[model samples]
Structure formats: C-alpha cells, structure tokens
Target chain A: MFKPFAFTLAAAVLLTGCSAQSGAETQGGGLADSLPSLTGDYVWTVNAQKSTVKFEADYNGAFSADFSRFAAAIKLNPDAPETGEIHAVVDLSSVRADDKDVTNNLPTPAWFDIKMHPVATFKSDQISKTDAGRFIADGTLTLKGISKPAALTFDLKTDGNAATADGNFTVNRMDYQVGTGSDFKDESWVKFPVKVSVRIEASR
Target chain B: MSASVKSTYTKTAIWLHWMIAALIIGQLIGGKVMHAMDPAPLKFELYQLHKSFGFIILALSVARLLWRLGHKPPALPDGMKPFEKIGAKLSHIAFYILMIGIPISGWVMVSSSPYIIETKIFKLIPVFDLPGVPRTEGFNALTKDVHEYMAIAIAALLVLHIGAALKHHFVEKDDVLNRMAPRIKVRR
Candidate 1:
C-alpha cells in the first residue's frame, strides 16, 4: 500500500482572521461555538483544472481536494452511526479553485474574496443515512459574517486499518453574498455546487 | 554458404537471441494479464516488472539484430522458393519493429504517469525519463491506448510467423525449418 500523507484545511487560514472577528461580533467565535470532538487530519486537494461547476452537478467528479493544511476527528457510535459528529475547516481564502489571474479574480469582492474574509469552516449537527446507505451530515457553514445551514451527502467507510469519506454538494453563491459585481440582471446568480471529497487515516 | 553460417554461433550470441525472444513473449503475456487486473498496488508492481523485462528485451534484441545483420545467417539449401525468402524477411522486419515499439511506448507511458513511484529497474538505471507528466489525470492515457493497440499488432504478426514456420516444417517438407532449427538436419 502507498503511504497516505494527510492534513486538514482551514481555507488556508487567512480568511479565518477577519471572519472569526466578524463572527465574534455577531454569531460568537464562528464554528467554535459548536465544535465536533473528532480529531484526525484530512487532506483535500483541489485541482481547479479538474473541478467543474454547473447549474446541474455531476456525481462522478465526486472527488477530493488536497487540504494539507487542516485535519478532522469524528465521534460516532457503531450502533447509532446516524448520531455521528464531525467538523472541517478550509483555508477558504486558499482558493485552489483557479490558476494565476483567474484565482485572483475569484477570491475578490464579487466572489469568495479571501482578502477581507479568508477562512470558511463547517460543523455538523446531525449525521444520518439514506435508504441507499450514503451519509447525510447536516451542519452550519460560517463564512464572513453569515451562518447558513447546509447538508453534505457523504459516502463514508471506516475499518480498523483506515477510513475514507467523500461527498459532493452544490449551493448558490448568492445565498452567501457571493455575487457578481454588477447590476442589470441583478437577480442574476451563479451557484457553485462545489464538489468535495476527503480521504484520511486515523492514528489512534 | 556464408562464411559466418559455416561456423556455429558463439554461445553468447545464441543465448542473447533466445533470451530476447523468450522475454519479449513473456513481456507480452505480462502486458495482457496486467490489462485484466484491477488497479491496486500489487497490479501496479506487476506492470513495473513487465517493463523491467521489456527493457532487457530491447537491449538483447538490439544485440541479436546487430549480430544477425553483420554476421550473415546460414543460407537456405540450394533451390529454396523465392516466397519463403520473402516471408522470412517480412516476418523479421515485423518482429524488429514491434520489439522496439512495445518497450519505447511502455517507457513513454510510464514516464508520463504522475502516479509512478519508482523509475528505476532492478534498483539501477532511471526508466521512462519523461517526467512532469500526470498519469492519472492527463495526457498519459492516450499513449497507453496506443501501446495497447500496437501490442495487438505485434501479437498478430507473431502468430502469422509461427504458423507459417510450422506449416513449412510439418507439411511442405521444406528446408525453412532446417535453417533456424539446428538439430533437424542431424535427425534427418
């Protein structure tokens, strides 16, 4: 087997400063207010060259993004797997979402501007399973000064040797004030059903 | 009779020829089996071995080809048919092309893959030197596809050559077999 070098992401952390301060002024300590007791590092690699976003999401691109920056830990009963808890932090400001100029354009005012607010974090409240055996983790996603409830569907498996988890979810940028810097079609909107996947090994 | 053919082959030359032949066939078999296997660490390891042997084939085949061309092979007995000579030359040309192509293509494909861990064969000599290529998510797939198709081409040519040789030996009572099979004349 190949060695799995892993780490978790905190949206590369820069955005975390401004957003954490904003959340303290409003929602209080951002996701720190609701933390998951899990501890383990998870790596998410995002190849903007590999990622594609459309109004309609495709599942096969249900892939991973490298987050050599952050880690995660989970607490769930084997008997009541549905009652699981997990948390993930991404260097929201580290947008591997584009290369060079495109990247700068994306994390700017009209988009996910990492300049003013750089960190985006998530904390799960409920973890349940579908009839088809996939996981649905519902949580609050905190970015900038906004906290919104979002759910991610994960195909997760755990064994004594290692654990793997993957999920893809799409949400509109407008809901998070991530909009184009324009007027006319002001009702105009672009949603990024950002595809995300995670694979990690736990040491204890 | 050619002066080179009158004398028997040197042991090293003979060994190099048969070894190249045997390993090329072995590499071909390994390539076929590797294709059917699922993607796993073990499967990847098998492919690594196949390419290692493939490099050996290229080297030995080159030696054998040079020895054959410079040292003329045993001539056919008097009155050999013209088509038999033509067939022998065509088959050899096909074999040489494939022997060189298969390994070169495999090396290129391996070099292009980002997932490839070790480029060394037998812990010596760097293999498939083209780096900076991503095997899993980029241009490597196209070369792999071409390598596979060309393997089929080589296999087809091999079958035709073997079948024709067998026909000449068992059915036609011709000297074609005697030229390559050293012991047949003694048996007759």
Candidate 2:
C-alpha cells in the first residue's frame, strides 16, 4: 500500500520538476496580462475566510474541516475552456480545525495517516462550466493509493482582468478506506467530504 | 616510567572515560538512525542533534587527553603475562587516536559540505571558519571517506576489546573487567 504511495510521491516530485521547467519557459519573454487571462501561470490562492470545508456524520456533529492552506494550479484557456487543466493538492494533513480534539485526530494513521500518505491530490481530467457561473471540476482524487471518481462544483466569477472560482464536494472517506474509524480515537459518523473554494490569478 | 606499566585510573579519569564512552554510543546510534531518514524538517532536526553531540565528543576527547597527563594511572595486576600487557597497551593507544580523529574528520566533512554549517555549536554560534588544511569540494569527500573507514576500524577494535574482556572473565579468571568494573582492588 505504502509502496505505491511512495512511488507516486517520487513521480509527483519528478513531474512537478518538469512542469516547473516548462512553466518557467512559458513565463519568460512577456509582460503578464491581467484580467480574464489564461495563457500564463495562474495559482489559485485558497481564501480560507470565504472557504468552508467540513465533514459530517451521524455520531459526530462536524468532526472534520480543512483550513486555508489548500492550494492548486490551473492552466485555463478562457477562449477554449476545453483545454484548461488543473492540478491541486490539499495538504489534508495541513488542515487545522478550530476544534483541538478533531484537529489532533486528523493526522493520525487512523485518519489522514500523514506519515505514509502525506498529501491528497486532485488532477482534473475535464473541467466544464455552467451558464450560472458555477464550475465543475472532474478528476480522480488519489488518497492513500485509492483513486476514485470525484467531481467538485462551486461558483466562478471573472472581471475584465481577474478570474475567481469556488467549488465544494464531499468524498466518502471509506471509498478510499482512509482508515477504519474507532469510537474512541477515530470517529466513524462523518465521511471526509472536503469543500474547496479557490481563487486563481492569471496574466491576460 | 616503570617497565611494569600502570593498570588503574584515577576517579576523575574514570568519570571522563566512561562519560565519553556513553556519549560515543549515543551518537553512533543517533547518527545511524538519523541518516536513515529522508529529507524532511524532522530528519534535519535529528541531524542537528547528531552533529552537536558529535562536536561534544571532539571537545571531550581533547579535555580527556589534557586531563590524563596530570594523573597517575594504577599499575596492572602483577600476575599478567608479558605479551598480554603489550597488546592491551596497544589497543588503548588506538582508542585514544580514534576518539579524536573520527570527530575531527567529521567536522572537516561538515565544513566542506556546502549546505551544513561548520559549527552548529549550541546553535548559538554559526560557522566562523574551518581551521587546518585547505577547504574544498574534494576535501569533503575525502573527509567523509576518512570518517567512515575510521569508524570501521574503531568498531573492529571494540569487538576485539570485548572479546578479550570476556575471555579473561571466563577462561583466564583475571579481573579483566575489574578496572572498568564498579570497584578496583589495590594491593600493598
């Protein structure tokens, strides 16, 4: 189980390195254009204040929440929305809930199992938008070596120079079988459904 | 000065000796376990502890040597065989050499290393400068080799020392572990 996780981590690092090299090349030789842009590098800054991510269950009122450190990169082609690509990593381990008890339990092997599976990642296969300014990001969320079909939706707004989008989704932690919850240490009532709110910045 | 050399150590001498022994044991294990870790904030943290403790070994070694000249070591048991005495003395010499050499080399290795500081001393003082011999990229690799090979040699010697002590305890029936033991007997 951890073998694949380790391999993927190494692969992720390598791919990230290659992508950064390519991003650097694309960033050169031009003044970045602002407002409703998609060609240059655009980083989605997670607005923790506006973002609310929570996981709920029968036994627990709200045992899980993700903080503002959530971040990702999106390569959007505003003219050709089909070509837009998104890569985001929610350091689920980085999630700091206001509740101390819940926060302590989140990083354990029985929970996020941060030591073995450190980062939870989402890479979009296809992203589409609705006429209502709401956006849909479809991709496989790889958690603990288990890949599942996951879709996220939220509101997106673009002014003449800047663009912003938000999304919320719930995932049954058991789908990936993150860890078998316990009554004392692990809470089983709520699935690890993460709500994502993102704001991306790009040059025109 | 006598042909029949001494066998016992003074109170302060024994304390320094065992303290160094304890520190070396702790550091070797620390270095081994820490080196096994991948690069992370905590792994680097462990390396800092290991490095600081290593420097302690270097400092203690110097102090121990300085403290030794002022003290009179007790004579060996009058009944010991001649060749055994020569061999015992030779091993002690090796131990002293290794005590200082290995850590100096480690410091040199760290100095030559571009990333790590020369002195992680108390985490207070940063690297001032590396003393003795020119510092270069090549020196780092060479010092690393020296530290590693010296460790192998020291470990081999330690195994031999223990084997000899066990041999005396069971076969020779001499108090081989006596000097390093809880109590030493003095003869008039």
lDDT of 2 by residue, B1-188 (tens): 32343565656777778888888778777777876775454775776677777778888888888887676666655667899888888998898899898887787787665332335566765544466645555777788789878877877887888899888778887655666664445532
The reply for model 1, stretches above 4 Å from the true place, is A1-204, B1-10, B123-125, B131-138, B172-188
TM-score of chain B of each: 0.79, 0.82
lDDT (0-100) at residue A96 of candidate 1? 50
Give Cα-based local distance difference scores for all models. 0.53, 0.56
What docking class should model 2 receive?
incorrect
TM-scores of the candidates are 0.47, 0.45
Q: Could you tell me the C-alpha RMSD of candidate 1 in Å? A: 15.2
Least lDDT summed over 10 consecutive residues: which range in candidate 2 chain A? A8-17
The 10 consecutive residues of candidate 1 chain A with the worst lDDT sum are A9-18
Q: Which stretches of candidate 2 lie over 4 Å from their true place?
A: A1-204, B1-7, B116-118, B125-127, B132-136, B183-188
RMSD of each: 15.2, 14.2
Cα TM-score of candidate 1: 0.47
